[model samples]
Target: MIINCGPLTGFTQARYVIHMSTGKRLVLFRLPSIDPTSSKPNEKEGWSYYAMEAECPHAGGPMADSLIDIEDSAYVASCPWHAYDFNVETGESSVGIKACTYPIDVRGDNVMLEFPAEDGLNVALSKIEPVSEKVKLKNARPSETPTAKQEDSGMARYLDDDATLCDWAVHILNTAHPEHKIELTTHLFAIFTEREASSSPMEIGRGTVTAPDQPPREKMLTVNPGAMPRTGRGGTLKSRIAMLHALANIELWAIDLAIDICVRFATFQTEKSSEQLPRAYFHDWLKVASDEAKHFSLLRTRLEEMGSHFGALPVHHSLWLSAQETAYDLRARISIIALVHEARGLDVNPMTIQKFRLSGDAESVEALEVIHHDEITHVTTGHRWLTWICNQEGTDPVQVFRSNVQKHFRGPLRGPFNEEARLEAGMDKRYYEEMPNVVAAS
Candidate 1:
């Protein structure tokens, strides 16, 4: 609970300011009430300090300048911007939502706040975009003439029209730059927050949208499955990072595949409309897409921590090939992509977790564990939707899935299969049990 913020600065000497490990700024106001048992450096036995989020929630107004001492009252820090007030103890905002507050403590003469033992989320920059320093240096270059300086134009919205919301998601898919991650995250956030990217249907242009190339440096050095260099694992750090990058690459493509499915199949006929299947269908893909984004970011961060990056090594384009094969059909897409391919991911993740554990890379292990559980849920969504489609068409779900696999998926279905995870994900045994026999009989 209480983490050492290191000897409460600005106390007993200057105006108090403190920064949390999570990059949140806080200011210490009133001192703590007396605690007789406390033996801290500047032992003000019963003293504690009140701290509030450094900036006002309303408009980034300064909370320090407008500080209010309530004389042992509930409400502590007050913001002058909109006259908002908050309780330093609880972070409760007088207007509506709670303010950000921290529990302050002094130990061994060191000031500490209630922070966790583990490092918080890797809010560390992933470097998908250039650093601001580079931009500043470029702007500082000397100009030959004192002509009117041209300011950079503002970015244009991808789809421009809210009605063609699906088209905007497709635009994100087609963006091949590394910065696409930023745009994709922003777009997904907007959708969940009900700002832009609506589920409303609009008649798209005649041609179908093709999936974009993976971000540029990432699209580098592609190799066939057999050509993939054996990634080192076990005790060596290099191999561990290399292996994590390979997995991250798969997740990156999975994001694209999920996006492709949503845009590609938005036109499937249903009882609802001709423009696309109901929002339910696309929403399912969006959920998968969202998880894939998180998985990729987690794995990518882990990779960077180990001194390698996602595109620093070669990757097989194997996942996208399945996308191309199923580009035209919803049945084949879910059957082959989610059930067959991703289910294999489920089967192997436990062993992968063990590999990272053996290497003593707990961070990588944790990321893989998250992706592993999510894959089970992702496959469950695919199976549910696949079943829904089968019912809509009045066909047997298992048989149709089998037929689609045979027609679309190449070669033998390989697996020591993660039967438990498959079952957990709602995949029936009869489906896989009959699949090999059905394929063999065919």
Candidate 2:
């Protein structure tokens, strides 16, 4: 069973420990310690006698609203109030880390923590907590910008396409370089205007841009032209080999954007006050980047079996387009890519799997399942960051999300929107419940 402590409540032996199953993880605590207790007691309140695990590593403030950094197996917690970091394992100040850390110990299947005892200023403290030193981290720098080297990754290539009509759709979908994204997009416009297919680089599409802001003028592109692989390859291994190649190519592209969005933009720039994103965010994003590459490789292999290759069918480029449009705005970027598009993947993936299964292609289905599961986590990340951005701006995240969706996307958000997936992805309850109400055009 899982026991979640109050957001502001710190480690109290009774309030903190939970008996988790093997391989299970719990949300041990929300905020680290807002009501820090240091040798204080209150019999009337029935509890007392505890101190903060560590000072706000950011600037010796209280650690509040934080989560343990399970990714590194390090004893650290992320401060929710200001994103100040700390090291719980050593009780040392992870102040420069710019995120909060909390102390925790797991004994066998049980997790234990020492709750800080609260002082008598309960009512007075509640009002002051938000504005207190605990809530503010000092001298944090802005988030790290992507370095020049990173600008040359596979994903970066995809982002460099020009913004033309037919080619626009292609650029959106193509796993080209980032710097080339604008040029690719520009080519799209020229291609559409030319009508006649040019000897242009592998761009496949209708030569037109429909909605100035929407997507491919023609929504129905399928797997055919890009099919028919080169002969003289291997046997069953050929497909697998091809898949690996495509996966590697696409993955490099996918992870680059994931890292930029999750770490640099969301975690560092938007979520943390001191402007330093949690190091854990970097690790997490890299892992995701690797996983996405694996998924793409796996799927590419499956496609090869059907005499098709990665570029056979025209894949919509909206996914990256959304990422591109919101490049400057992490919140908007996550909202579109992670939340909206990834969420859509939750729904669409099952159908893809079903199609593969019906075709007796179990291998393809398995690859898709891997993507489906991982996509959920990706969506969850988006949800967390989006919520954080909303909180930072002090606006109703859901409302802001709605307006952004209207402003950004073209086709209405279809329902069959994987409601179950959305909940698991950390979409707010109200948003999930009211999803049907957010009608996309028919």
Candidate 3:
């Protein structure tokens, strides 16, 4: 049986997945231009194509987001989840495993894949429905720039000049679906980055926005902290999955927290201060929101691979509760959410990574490593902004951070801390070393 994947023009270095009715999946990839002296196959000497199973053999990692590169005269795709490389043509891996490959033929402008004929084979292409065409915002200021056309996911909602960064923040905050929230968060960040790189003016209308008290979450089970299940040391598969689900939930809330601080306090001006926050402040938090979205995506994918998923287990409302306590003060928000909660992550992530390592779950380890690296920069961003705000107020940032934690945070800081990572993020030991050392509630 043959299936027409799509036009060759639609293909790039990015991997695309093709689903078959036989419950099998194939990923299509376009090879880059290869050198003439390379030992590639004749049909694959120049720009070519190949199809392989969409799931990585290692941990069922999604290959559609794999990183493609040329190595040893061969095109290789590295699985995004664990960085396992596979030869595009042969599906051969250096780790003694092989992904199933299929035959492909390009006819004119179309790319086709061949599969074994079966008694009840179906090759109908899955239809992609479009997202809502436009999101109307009340009191939106008209701009000269026309709204960009909505594509596969209707990501064009905020591309026009009239939609302020605060507008986008509120939109994301109000989204209830997890996948849609992730998509919107990512697209908002991409649009912001593109505009910045081109030196285009991005409207950030402060004092005209009001973020939701709490972001909308769909059907997620929440329980008190004491009611949460024990995920013991990640020594068992169930325990590891529970740990990942908990982390995923945290990252989801973190995405909201990052974006929330942007618009929720967009109008904030300390006493004796007249200026609102600079654009760079919004940029930093948008990047943080984007990173949190990515971390949540990784953890969710890992959970599915392990036969469980987010929302499968009850989560604690402690994270969002903290967000609420600090909602009235930007300094308190930054102090508790970033400096305290995120800094606590910096302390605990290494041990979490080690737990996955001990269990031989390399895929989970790789995902956690990426989160750990990005979180260091997140803590750094929090510190940088906190200091900037304190400088404006003519107060010591350390004093302010300590004050906010003592006021808004529920319990004392605990340690067996990762001091090195904390220092690297500009969080000095003085920030927490002298804080009350009472044992934290479970």
Give the winner by TM-score: 3
Taking the tens digit of each residue's C-alpha lDDT, what string does model 2 give over 1-442? 1222223233333112222222222223322232344322211132221223333444332233243443243335554334444554444444544332224433333333433333642211111112111101122222243223445333233223343223334334343432233223323333332332233433322224221232222323334424624422223445444433443344434644553443235323544444444434433443444456456545555555666655543443434556667766666666677667667778776765565566565666666676776766667666666676666757687877766676566656776667766765666456534443343332
My TM-score estimates for the predictions, one after another, are: 0.60, 0.45, 0.65
Query: Clashing residue pairs, candidate 3?
Result: none
Q: Lowest summed-lDDT stretch of 10 residues in model 1? A: 129-138
lDDT of each: 0.62, 0.44, 0.77
lDDT per residue (tens digit) for residues 175-196 in model 1? 5543344345345533542321
The C-alpha local distance difference test score for the whole of candidate 2 amounts to 0.44
Ranking by lDDT: 3, 1, 2
Model 1 bad stretches (over 4 Å): 1-163, 182-186, 192-219, 270-276, 437-442
lDDT of 3 by residue, 56-121 (tens): 898776676554656686778766445578998889988889988888887766777777765675
Ranking by TM-score: 3, 1, 2
Residue 204, candidate 2: Cα error in Å is 37
Better of 1 and 3 by lDDT: 3
